[model samples]
Target: MKHNELKTKNELQEKSLFDKTVGRRSFLQYAGAGAAGIALVAAGCKKDRGYENPVMGGATLDFKDDFGVLNYAYALEQLEAAFYVKVASAPPASFTAAQKAYFQDIQFHEIAHREFFKAALSTAAIGSLEVDFSKIDFTSATSVLSTAMTFEDLGVAAYNGAGPRIKDGGYLLLAGKIVSVEARHAAYIRDLISNGSFADLNSLSAFGSNNAGGLDGALTPDKVLPLAQPFIKTKISAINL
Candidate 1:
């Protein structure tokens, strides 16, 4: 990464909206709702065994190179963009105006991320994946924010784990930029749901020991897919990943 680019990313992180204090109303927006209790449809998904074998059956991430990783990221961006678009179309009745506006901003960011990967991958990009959000309750603020938190956290982990696997520095740089935005989204959503819990032990423990080192979590493709599979209806045949 260029020195200026690095400095810009650092500055963005330093000025992250997650640093703001939450108003009591925003903190208790969904007083009786249990965000943790919202579950995804993981019934038929298989546990990820290894990278060599193709676990998902439909869209082909069949490349044995960095294209495979980029396509994987593209697929995830598709899911997230689709999700935010859905939420923005009809946000929960209880959401404050500011909350709704922030979600719209997030929607734009996810779409831009999705388009960047699609354009970068060009012909190698996998077909747009179908999403299954049947398990999410979009009408409830707690459910929507909880699912958003899940996606942003997963996105950050996916990028962190895949970064070391890319052979090209340019691609790595792109991933770094996108992942930092994702981390910001994760932190903001976490704070919205529960004030000051953005980098708490509970969040860190979910993705292993990033907490011990005071870093964000990372998860290999093998571990990320099965958890993601529930929300993604399109089968991502990730082979040689």
Candidate 2:
């Protein structure tokens, strides 16, 4: 199917799920209005965790409050979406037919996630970000899948770490839903890298838990942005975070 057609199909599926669980209107209501202030108020006492670097010099992420956090997520989604779209557009020759299909499905899902954030944030959302994948060898299965694994792991951590700062229950719920999907993608990619390694120690460690408790790691924005910055050419300013 064509890119636009695939995106539409996936969006319908996401909307259906959203409607069944929590109507889009209701979800937006929760995420809209004073949600940003509430998030700010909730995390007001904490020291700012925004980041900056001389190398980062492009689209800035003006994180005003919880909207800032959401925008951070939006930015990450943009990166992941871009990466998957590129891979799905022309998967590695070494990748099996099933793997190619999986990448396509993941591409749709990431695009849906990216679009959802853009719509939810509306005027508050950041612009689309430019990504640098020059280091990734798209024609090689090991290169592509490894890079995918890295992105998925970082995404899961970014959401987990930012969860506490989200004061609004509605926004929190939104983050929870998206992060779960990210974790699933991480596990799938892990297995693709090495069978039965999905739940292994290294995989669990990605969540920041080195112990048997299997807790997922929550990386603060300062930490996440640096790791993500390498792939993104946009200069993300989280000074207000």
Return the top candidate by TM-score.
2
Provide the overall lDDT of each model, using Cα atoms, as 2-decimal numbers.
0.69, 0.71
Residue pairs with colliding backbones in model 1 are none
Clash totals, every prediction: 0, 3
Give candidate 1's TM-score. 0.75
Which pairs of residues collide in model 2?
58-235, 207-216, 207-217
Q: Which predicted model would earn the best lDDT?
A: 2
Per-residue alpha-carbon lDDT of candidate 1 for residues 4-54, written as tens digits (9 for 90 to 100)? 554455334323312321111111121121322111111111121111222
Q: Worst lDDT window (10 residues) for model 1?
A: 37-46
Alpha-carbon shift of residue 41 in model 2 (angstroms)? 36
